[model samples]
Target: MRLNQPRIKPLSPEGLTPEQAEILAPLGGGGVIPAGPVLNIFRTMAHAPKALKAFLTWGNYILSRKNDLPPREREIVILRTGFLCKSGYEWTQHVEIGLRCGLTQDEIVMLKTGPDAGWSPADAALIRAADELNADYFISDATWAALLTYFSEKQAMDVVFTAGQYTQVSMMLNSFGVQLDSGQTLDPDLRKA
Candidate 1:
């Protein structure tokens, strides 16, 4: 959504090189070669199979159960980071992911409003941590202390990891002009960006 057209066009099925196809194999297997519509992010990332593989490996950790933060809390940090980065594509994609992870639509909307939008103290700490990470590249001691009150040290570390990962994702999506996938509608707040 950052640009009218993608800076690097996502490869079509016919255009995929063998390496790209292998990277995208999980999406479609056997002889299908990307069976369904690939999300713009993945398809675009496929352009660099090695990098895409690396991205997915680290990304898997952040999204996997291995992460100390629960799924809902992870989504909160991701959504907050996407919003703070003004990444419309990220916001659109993760809005669904956030909802599936137990974040209400109202909470997603509230993320755009700021960190103190009536979230519980623990959730507020997570949001503030994302905000601080986005704005200052570091979370304050007070915010860290707030987070420790409700989450383990490892969970707190996951908070930074999740926020940092999504921050990088948002930057890539915005800079690359990775648009929303099919059936996605842009949030009005990000229409200008």
Candidate 2:
């Protein structure tokens, strides 16, 4: 995505240390090492096994039903954040996840355009929140009010949480040069010159 190749190379599967294996284990199959190919993001993060473990714990919570934002809404924040960050790898990965969470392909394309792309009021607020968080690191009072109109207090919090989490993820994917996985294509808009 950001760089043509990884600045920090992913640990080769054949050469994983026990710590790496342990960290990567849960991401793939049930064993200490995965049965199949581990996703690129997980593999790259395995370089810091303890950190990856902690990251996964928090990530699990964010993706779980406990986050208050529904699955589709969460994906909207994530996709919008990824798009704003121009994180090609993050965008590629989450597009599929967003689709699974019930965002249509049209909605996915609309995410790239912004909050004004004919989104429903509730959806527009989510996108605006992500856009504000990315640009100002704070949602404006008007946008906050808009968010409150549609979301519960906890759901509003999750909106901020989801955007913050993906912002960090995008930074990592970009800075670490995490590439798209096998058969994944880079979004043309994200192509680096």
Candidate 3:
């Protein structure tokens, strides 16, 4: 919603080059990839096979349980980062993912109120981490301390990485003007961005 039109048009399924197809084949194998429609993120990224390949490697780790943050905690960071970055595509996609990961609709809505929304201390810490990272590019000592009280070193690191990765994704999706996939409704806040 940030741009009226895409800066670079997303590729259609028929438009993929063989090299792009080779790099993207694994996406189909993962249950994470939806069967009916390929997301515009994938279609657009396929334009650069090498970059897309490298992106998928880090992305897989972040989405996988190997990242140390539990799924709900991870979605907290992702949804907040996506919102802070004003990325409709990222936010909309994550809303679905967040629900499956155990975030209730009320909790997801409260993320917009940020770290001070009367959430459990641990959840507030996660939101504050994202907000601080988005605003300062570094977490403040207070937020870092709060985070340490509840998170292991690995989980803390995952928080930073998740925020950073999603920030980049937001930038890409916004600049690219990647539209929402079918059935996705843009959050009103994102629409106004």
| CA RMSD of all predictions | 3.1, 2.6, 1.3
Off by over 4 Å in 2: 29-36
lDDT of 1 at 126: 96
Q: Which clashing pairs does model 2 show?
A: none
Could you give candidate 3's per-residue lDDT for residues 20-106 as a string of tens digits? 888766664355555666677887888888999899889988999889999999999999999999999999999988998999999
- By summed lDDT, the worst window of 10 consecutive residues in model 3 runs over 28-37
TM-score of 3: 0.95
- All models: lDDT? 0.86, 0.89, 0.89
- Pairs clashing within candidate 3: none
Range of the 10 consecutive residues with the lowest summed lDDT in candidate 1: 27-36
Task: Give the worst 10-residue stretch by lDDT in candidate 2.
Answer: 28-37
Query: How many clashes would you count in candidate 3?
Result: 0
Put down candidate 2 lDDT per residue, 1-193, tens digits, no spaces.
Answer: 6799999888888989998998887677432223567888899999999989899888888888889999999999999999889899989888888887899999999999999999999999999999999999999999999999999989999999899999999999999999887888888988886
What's model 1's TM-score? 0.94
Model 3: C-alpha RMSD to truth?
Answer: 1.3
